[model samples]
Target: MLMFSEDKGKVKFNKPLYGMTGKYTLAEGISLPYFSSLLDIDRAINELRIAEQVPASLEAKWSLKELFQREIDEKRVRQDIVKGYLLDPKKLKFFNAITIVLMPKGADDKILDSFENDSTIPPPTIPWEGNDVEDGQWNHPNARIANFGGVQFISIGLSARLRWDENRVLAVAVDGQHRLSALRTFREDQEFGRSGSLRTHEQETKIPVLFVLLHPDAGFLNVSVQANYSIRRISRELFTDLNKNAKTVDKARELILDDKSINAQCVRTLLTESTTEDIPGLLPLSLVRWQDDFNRFDTSYYLNSLVHLNLLVSEILELKDKELRDPMDKKQVMGFIKSINDALGINGQEVKDGERPLTRYYLEDCCEDEEDPHTPFSRLPEHYLDSAVEGFIVNFRPWLLRLLLDFKPYQELLAYARQYNLIEGNFGKFQAQTSKHKNAILQQENTKDSEWNKREILIPQSAINSMKENQWAFKAIFQKAMIRLGRIIGFEVRSENKNLGNIDDFLNFLNGLYDKGILRVDASLPDHSYRLWTFIALNPGNEKIKVNRAVEDRIFSLLRLWYFGTRKIQIDTAAGEQILSNRKLLQFFAADKNRVHWPGCPEAYETLRKGFDVATLYRKDSNEITIEEKKELVRVRFSAVLAAGLPVLSQLQRGALHEQSSEYYNQDNES
Candidate 1:
């Protein structure tokens, strides 16, 4: 066991720990030799009375000494560090040398003997020198001594002080006591094997220690605290990957150096330089739970979510076919960033950091009174049209592409209808907030101009222009299209209770729908039963059965006019704020639990294509007929068509049930 020398002021060693060893002075009164070796740390555990705490009820004489009397559980030390080391000796290479502070009980001048020059061994290399060295500086050079001791005591830098006479503790461990205890336990065969004698013939292991001598001075106690607590250590995350130089900062630097994309560059800029008054990376950094060492060149406190953000951006740029969008070059991606920033009202003048993007930008001031039809979301709330943006795109992109693929003929037909007023509704007045003249239609001389000045054409300019001119029209059109699509296939999307009002209320309602499995829009098709619209695209290879793109666009345009322009159903009203009490009118399109169908049922579409005017089913003006009178007319005209498809639907439902039964029986037999 390592212990104090016979002199009590110096550290004693039975044999040389490493090939070279000597003693040297550090600062004015401290000095010790430093070397690296395997240490039996278990033999060096020391508990010293370091501090005290007194309760309010006790007198002031209780003193502060009781604070340091708290004992460390040695078993915890063995389990955490020692057992792992014995199992794999390779783990022993990481710990620094143990520190021992020796305070001789009485004033011992002989302790300074080691601080003096030793003629027997070569002089030690001290780390620091000159007047810069203060008394408390741990790395200060050793002061020269006048006496020469026969025994060689080498001090490279590690040292401890000893307090004699006052306490028989003799020596105290300032650091690494757990390591010492674990070493002791392993040595005593309390670890590794059942018999514990498997490693009895092991080679001698030595631990390098620094020894300092002090004469029980108050200054020495302060020095012990300073020695143990002052030095800053690397973070655990950085320390584990030290061999590969893998640190948070390093990863950030790599992204800046290799990835020159605008988004990546923005991330780099946020980490490296403060572009705004506040730290640009603060919000992102706050989300990070780990960081690299402070001394690392690329030590970033904030780049933890950089990877997730980049991945999201990448996905947003992909085409419906899962291919990289040909139009999404660097310039296009930058444009998208600017557009998103504009939509969120995030001015690029200052990059806000350390905030949740969704909460800060999207959810602010969105919820409002549903009774008011004047308000609209500040940004285009397309995501609110569906619960999941990914699912929304998946369902709509194919449908949209099929429509846009042959849009020229559809546009001409719309132009013809507008010019002649042949459609059911009049597009003669403007009800949008953007327009000054309430009664005049906003006519664009350059009708083909791009809406946002971006070079992309996913949908027709005429359609986009109409929607932008009146956002209320867009919401009405979107619902009509959804209902029409649902009718063509046999699925019903809207529920009576789920009818919500306005954009914000609808967003909340969609969230509820998602929870109730009503709007379970996910990527997996086989697991989803609500995606009846997808079946149109899944039609078997028969070209005759497949719906044509021009036909689809015509139907979509027809429904938009039939609902928004003719029926004049305000966005909030259709959203379910004030329930449309026309149950007879709704039953003509929307399906109940038993019979599933929507507005654009194929038979209904055939009826409309044969030049049937939908305005004939409902009252256009109160002067002509009352709501109840129109409801009677609608019920009479659509009762037969509503019941016509029941036989086909029943046949399909029966076949599906039989297939499900067969699959379950097969699985049960196999099990």
Candidate 2:
């Protein structure tokens, strides 16, 4: 039996355990003695139990059990471990320690009968064997107890061998439950040859473990002592200390910290170099809420958050289809990256570092099988990344920035803020104060009635009210829809198409509608039934804009039809026939057949009615046309319509910016 004791000889344990003993000082007067060891795979899987399986009495006291450990994610166990680490066990390595709390078996267990029956069971004592020992009563041969200025210290020369009875104790893992679950799953899978079978030698793999004892008078230890705190209380404190402080990286932080993704690299460059002389960034650092996951309704000071911006960058680079967790098709991804580089005017020869092609910029074999390659810019030459970032700034960034800035509400908000001096140079500081202002209003207590409540009011009430009034314009979904519209109309600023004529006309028309309150999220409007925004964007039930892909797509299609009709784009006979017979557009326009009214201007409705007449003519002789022919005909008509509108759409004048110079603020003196 192995034995261990504290330096002052206040606490001791005697059991058959194979590990080194140490004490972790939690506070000035409180410390927990721990046993660190490497347990064989089989032993750890069998011996250790999760906190939920502990005896009812012990479980009841540990009210923090749910908070202490998370439910084991079975998907993580199967995919990340069984399919990842265990796929090759010979080179397996797990550096993290599996932390477990040791509790003595309850009174019901027969294993603890000896300790319970005997009121004074003698603690197992081991004699020191070294000649250097004076009393030969030390826990270790090379141990020495000394006093340094009234403080006692004990030293075990190299390592302290500790022992613990495995059967008489209950072991519960407080941390690394996922890893433990993975181990258990791997072992079970090995027995059935499910996930690559492990050989006999591989099955004996050992993992690091840390066993902690919360109380000195633990029943199985057969020792009696008094302490200020119970085992359950200490266990709860330890669990909270471990988990509460360990922060999980949110989406915004992940994007900021990412060094591999080309999309992330571009986003970071834009945010950091917002005021670069050569190509001024459209997305100012101050306006971006990079720390937030989603834009809060109450906090409308920022333009957009990191998550949406990253997605936009991906869409611009044609990398939106691939997710970070999805398996990499290296060859396909490399080809796509090469195309993006070519379009950006990066000939791969511009940047030095062996003067390689765009495809050769990144490492050929930087990742393992089944792992995501992330982006072609990952592990690329630093000079090439710089060139790539520059290319995006010059070619792609301007168009996207223009598209976002062209939104009437964004323009008006910026102008209003500038005119009123609501925001100075530093956007981050202003955003922080805005958050404080929101909090003060929410908490409604503790905040004094002095300038403490008004000191951070950088954004005036007028700007806030304006933002709240046009809330739909600042929505992530709305911006995403705009980007999609830009792509559809071939206005995605590229090297070849520098002129944003077509996109400008479309925005002006949309903004005109916005100015007339057609896009307002109010179901009580007199023209609610006839409003195009109602059918396309706003949810009638909630009187709020529906923020989903389906709604976004419908918005694009309906807008495209309106734009084409307004521009009077001509279509071929066959294609025109198919467009008129388009049941999707027909159903959308005539949602309530009882009231035969179109949503747009009378001129546009007349144009649509004339087109519907063509469908009537085609329907009389429609028996001859097949379904496939009809689909192809409709696609041809849509393409022709977009092409015909392009020239005239670009020639249309850009819309003038509108301004609202109204200031309204009310303060409450109630405290």
lDDT tens per residue, model 2, 1-671: 23343322432343333556677664555556666778767667766776545655554544435436566676666655555456544434664888887544544531121112122333334432224243233555566442211111233643334333333455667777788877767767653374544468866688898877554432112123233344444455667777778777777878887654567777776554432112233555555676567643324566566778887776656642343233246766555555556544443333323456555544443344435554332233343555667766765665676666666776776666565544453333445445677575635622444443343454354355557565556667666656765654442432243222366666775686567554455523221132234434664445466777766665555454555444333232324643322223322333334122222323232333333223322343677876444433433333233222233332333210011111100100110
Query: Total clashing residue pairs per candidate?
Result: 48, 3
Give me the candidate number with maximum TM-score.
Answer: 2
The lDDT leader among the candidates is 2
* RMSD per model, one decimal: 25.7, 15.0
TM-score of each: 0.25, 0.49
Candidate 1 residue lDDT tens string, 531-644:
221222222223122335434444353332233211223443556654222222233233223123223333333333232223433436656777445434433332222212
Which stretches of model 2 miss by more than 4 angstroms? 1-247, 272-282, 296-299, 320-391, 425-430, 433-452, 455-462, 488-529, 540-543, 561-671
Error of 2 at 557 (Å): 2.4
